[model samples]
Target: MRYIYDEQGVTFNYFLLTFIAIFLIPTTYFSLFSTDKDAKLRKPSCNCEACLRKENYLKNRKLSSTDRISKKLAIFVAVGWICFAYLVYKVTTVKIEIDVWDPYEVLGISEGTPLPQIKKHFKELSRKWHPDKAPEDKKAEYESKFIDFTKAYKVLTDEDIRKNYEEWGHPDGKQAYSLGIALPTWLIEAKNSPFVLGVYALAFGIGLPFFVGRWWYSSNAYTKDGIRTHTMDLYFKELRNNSTIKQLLDLLSASVEYKELVEQRPSDTTLLPQIISSVKEELDKRFSEKYQPSKRYIAPYCQKASALFHAHLLRINFSDEDLLKDKYFIAERSIHLINGILDIAIAHRWLQTSLRCMELSQLLVQAMWFQDNSLVQLPYINQDIIKTMKLKKKNIRNIIQLREMNDEERKNVFKALSPTEYESLMRIASIYPLLKIDQAYFKVAGDAIITPGSIVTLIIKLRI
Candidate 1:
């Protein structure tokens, strides 16, 4: 409680009445009610702590036209306050008033109060209102008042926040300097947004670990020995980790060179298995050599290995260009592609070749796992075709007649045979164990150099 004039006032009797009347007042009333732009501009709508304190000062000083309320409301509110103040003054000789929101006013202390004095006053007020000391009927009421006092004490005693309240009427004063409610100036002033920091954190913290883990998981891989290995691009003289297998798979997947080869399979179902198996067998034989592996070949080795792969594809009766240049085939049929490639690598017998083959094998296994195809898709024979051919075995032998046909005649014969018989019989010749194991056929194969446009015979030599 505070009084405009009192010698020994001691209670909030006058303060409560004064507090009610003060809110009814308005700052605009100081214009005597002129709201023109100039008047409004002259009297800004300030709610800063400075302005509120000034108003409180005026309210305590004396009654005057300084009230902020309109004339009519002021008349009613002022008369009502006067009556209450006078009644309490006569009955109790006590006059005290304080603004609830103003901590300085609530604590009955000036903004410039020293810390020691502030603490002393706070303790006195706290002890007076302590619930244990409060009257039974008024315990709850005193408890509420005690909370208000404690909050005020907390606000004023903190030097930094006290300064904030003195200047801005709020504990958090920096908000006054904000850009707007939507985005604070501090947010823009910062070097990076939280979102950008989050992305970097995700990449560095989680993404890096994931990539390394993937590399580690795929490190050890399948090799010609039918075992998994941790062989890196270089031999490790010390204990360390490597993950080349997954890395190679990623590169191969993105490669443009082997796109077609990865996807295309011979459309002739019966011939598909024969060509694939022949190629696989030959690669197996080349890789089965008993020799110590040397350090991988460099550029020169690459050229030789590449030429070998080309010839190797041809040996299995496939066009290298047709098979290795498609994209869908690479992405989808990588298993077959890797299988063939790895076999060639094993045949090379270089340390580099072995390592490269193991990497391809790892990739093939992973791709199969990814596509959920655990079992290899291989060519299957039809019983009907075998039975039909077996029934005509004698007739087939007679048809062949063992003639050394010229190129045109051989072409004509090939053209005459049904696609089924051509693929089936040719497959049997290539793979069937009971057929003649060792025979030789000689042909110039491509354009021959005799006299220009001269025809040549296709010669067959039997070594039985």
Candidate 2:
């Protein structure tokens, strides 16, 4: 009986060990082989059929209270493990940290802030938080703040960096910070260093005069194809402005008269005719007063205001021969005015690049206009004028030498030319020559020369 009891105890121990192993082996297999499905099972809450079936099975199970509690606890453990695994994966796989230094946030400004306001705010803040002003005891804390402030200020002030900051936020700002910050420093050093600055200065000093001299050589009002188009555009802009002004004046006058009529009583209807006459007189006076040239000589302004008027008129094929002949003197005076403006523009080293080019080109055009008018009015000049005025070999050689001289030297050479030489040189220099119009053959007073091949050549050469 004692031996039987010992064997039974051994068998019971073996049975318990086998049951534990069986439970653990299936769990391990599911965890490894059916990970996705096992993950679904381990979730705390799910709407899937598997989860619903498992939930129903657990609910309907006929078990002792202790057994039910154990099963529920096991389910809770599995769900907890799944959540822990997911949390670990997400923490490991995804970047959870971000850079703290944001230039835009430091500035306390954003896109589309007016430039004037930005400068004002920057100046205000810079004065308050500058490290130099901070007390020695607080210097370390303030110094970090100052560094951040300075960096923000630098980025905001710059156009390119500000644009990048506006586009991609902090990531792009970092790239811009790396590239843009370094460039300005490098540029400053390059500009300040005697060797580098001197080389550039020398090149520019030499090259600028050379370029302008070439431009002068090639200069003519109609020669530059783009200039003619631009000039025409400017004229149209002025015309539109003038038309707007005229319309506004008319509307104001009309409105005033209408208000007066509305205010007057019916008993004064007999006096309406007299009132109307008076109003007409007042309107005329007002118009004249508004249009008056003040102590300020405004004719110069008007001339400039309508600078490209002639160009536009020409473009539209307007027959303004009478106006051209009568108003030619006004145009001639404008040429001198434009030349003076050009002289001022050339002296201004800091003028905008595009405006500088425009002023210079306008000066050249004005000069050409004077030359063209003079030739057109000449009795003997004809289509052959270009060939006739072409410089003799000796003259060409002299002009070449003059080309190599400085501006002052070239001016002296220009002054030294004889009247006939000046006229001849100008004619040859003209991009557009007066074409021969045979009034007798064509029976038309004015006509453009239209020989097919010559037309093509002229168009190509003159860019007409």
Candidate 3:
């Protein structure tokens, strides 16, 4: 058996392999870069008690459940890059025996030379090395050289042979052509064939289905909002149009996220009694017995989660390292549960519940309790400062009203804050969104007034 290399086919394979190399570079870079970048925690904007505690907790917290998975994915991406590099080297370096029969190269002259130049070149070559003129010692080499030159010159000058060469790139018309594959030849050699096939079988047959099945299972387990199906079911069962804020907090405490935490560290059970006692003391001081979370038949993990959540809302910092770590984890995961609850609320068109859910989200972000004065969000402004201001009945509870105060009144109210503190307060206030309504009205298209069941468009023009 003989193998012929197709020059055109081999060149095309080179071009394709080059293109694949270019495509892999950015993909490999971004996958590796993002995995590392996203793992870093950003600095908190405020150094308030809550932010500081949260930061400390996070610093001390255990690695997330997804860390191992991320590392595994990064490893796979790296391995793919290594394989691509190896394939590129193999393909580019492989000794390709392309059998291109170029007439111009055979005659040692450029293509498209004039007919006269072609004749002169052949005549010159024949004078020196034609078979008839060869010395006895070099007769065989001379014959081979003269034959190649005569054949190339005939293909360029003779009308019939030139026509054949133009049509088929060879003097003999329509010669056999070999097909080339882009992959390196050694990949399919008998010695390595079984290993290569086994790799294919493992990747496509076993690995593919394993990954796809894992993805399918995960998709079924969670809602579109990233909350588990059973968790969402629990939310649907417990939530109502008139659910109180305390009840909502309790509902959040009962999420499956806490169960996962307990499962990760069984010793968290030891901290449970201490956390429950601290939360109970804070609640007794702040609210009547009616506002407290009920102890009736809740899971012990749920009870611990509820205690941690209440501790966060009450702005109580823990001295215990393990308890604070648990608090941080609970607070971090609560946002997802809150958003999941908000999704259910909006789906049911429960306006009040939806608003409460949004408020809870804001509470988590600002690290303030529902009953705390909004002024406390400002730098250097605590309960003591708020008391001195005696701002009751002024309707200046929010930042907007505080911004609207007369210059004299504003100075008087903020006298207790340092200049730096006041500047920080003003900076934060300036960035807060305030929409001023210029005009608003309802209109029905093709009608003078909005009628029952008509599609009414409410147009409100505002300045930001």
lDDT of 1 by residue, 1-464 (tens): 22132323432334555565566444325434655442222231233333444355344433443234446665775676577667566547534354337887878888889989999999999889988898999999999988878878878777877788777776666442322132223333457678667888999999999999887765544344432333222222211233244333433333223332233345434433444455456445544422211133223222222323322322233444343233223333444445544544445444564565465555343232222211111012122332344454522232223133344543443554455544543443334233343645434546555455555655755443
Q: What's the CA error at residue 68 for candidate 2, in Å?
A: 17
Q: lDDT winner between 1 and 3, please give it.
A: 3
- Which residue pairs in candidate 3 have backbone atoms (N, alpha carbon, C) closer than 3 angstroms, thus clashing? none
Tens digits of lDDT, candidate 3, 1-464: 33533433445456655776676676667655656543566676566555566566564442463477668767776776776676567667768675688888988899789989989998999998888888999999999999888879999889999899889988888877555555546566799999999999999999999999999999999887778888899999989999877778888888886787544457666766666676677656655342365564288778777777877876776677677767777888888789888888999999999999998888876667787778777666766676676653344588888888776777677787767667777777777788999999999999998899999899999999
lDDT of candidate 2 at residue 339, scale 0 to 100? 36
Model 1 misplaced regions, further than 4 Å:
1-101, 104-141, 144-213, 222-464
Instruction: Give per-residue lDDT, candidate 1, residue 266.
Output: 52
Cα deviation of 95 in candidate 3 (Å)? 4.7
**RMSD of candidate 1 to the true fold?**
33.5
Alpha-carbon runs more than 4 Å astray in model 2 = 1-97, 160-464
The count of backbone overlaps in candidate 3 is: 0
- Tens-digit per-residue lDDT, 17-109, candidate 2: 455456655665654465453223343243333335435544443234436665775675576556545544543565434356566577688
**Global Cα lDDT for candidate 2:** 0.42
Error of 3 at 232 (Å): 1.1
True lDDT of residue 47, candidate 2:
38
